[model samples]
Target: MTRSLPLLAALLALVATTPLHAEGDPESGQRVFNQCRACHVIENDGRNGVGPNLHGVVGRRAASIGTFRYSANMRELGEQGLVWTEDNLRAYLANPKAVVPRGSMAFPGLRNPAQVEDVIAFLKSRAG
Candidate 1:
C-alpha cells in the first residue's frame, strides 16, 4: 500500500502534465509548418538552410543545431539548459524576440493560437 501510494502519485502527476496535443492534428500542424519550411527544414537529412533543420527539435536543447551559427543570445539559451517543449515553443512562436530578445530568428511569429498549437503538433509528430 505504501509503494502503491507513490506509484499513484506519479501517475497523477504524469496525467496532469500530459500534452493537450497527445491527440493533436498532425496534418494540420504539417500544413502550418509549411510556413516555416521556407526558412527551416524539419527532416533528419542534416540540411541546414536559413534556419537550422528541426528534425528532432522537441526535447532538444536550444541552439544546438549543429553547424548552424546561432545568435549569441540563442547560444546563451542553449548553455542555460533550455529544452524545446510545447509550452515554450508556443511562447516562442507567438513572439521570437519576446521569448529571447536579440535572438536571431528573424521571422515574425505565428499570431494565431490554433496555428501555434498545430505547429507544436507537427513538431511532436516528427519527434523520434
Candidate 2:
C-alpha cells in the first residue's frame, strides 16, 4: 500500500504539471487559424503578412524573424531567452500583453481556452 501511495503521488504530480492544451486538435486548430490569417501565415513558403511568418514559430524565440519588425517588448523578451514552448504559447494566445507586457499585438486575444489550444496545435502542425 505504501508503494502504491508513492506511485499515485507521482502520477498526480505528472498530471498536475502537464499543460492543459496537450490534446489540442490540429484540424480544429486549422479552422480556428482562419481568425489569425489576417496577420499571420503558416505555409512553408508563406510570406510575412502584417505579422511575421509562423512557419516554425512553435520552437522559435520571440521576435526572432529578421524581416518582420517586432515591438520592443517582444524583441526584449527574445533577447531574454523567451522560447515558444507550449506553456508560453498558451499564455500568449490567452493574452498577448500578459506575456509581453509592452507588446503591440492589436488582436485582443482568444477567450475560449479550447480555441487557444486549437491554434497552438495548428501552429505546431505547421512547424513540421
Winner by TM-score: 2
Candidate 2 deviant stretches above 4 angstroms: 1-22
Candidate 1 C-alpha lDDT tens digits along 26-93: 79989988888888988777688888999888888999877999899999989999888877888899
Q: In candidate 1, where is summed lDDT lowest over 10 consecutive residues?
A: 18-27
Point out where model 1 deviates above 4 Å.
1-23
Q: lDDT per residue, candidate 2, 39-68, as tens digits? A: 988888778999989988998998998899
Residue 99 in candidate 1, Cα distance off native in Å:
1.0
User: What is the TM-score (0 to 1) of candidate 2?
Assistant: 0.83
On lDDT, the leading prediction is: 2
Q: Estimate TM-scores for all models.
A: 0.79, 0.83
What is candidate 1's local distance difference test score? 0.86
Please list all clashing residue pairs in model 1, or write none if there are none: none
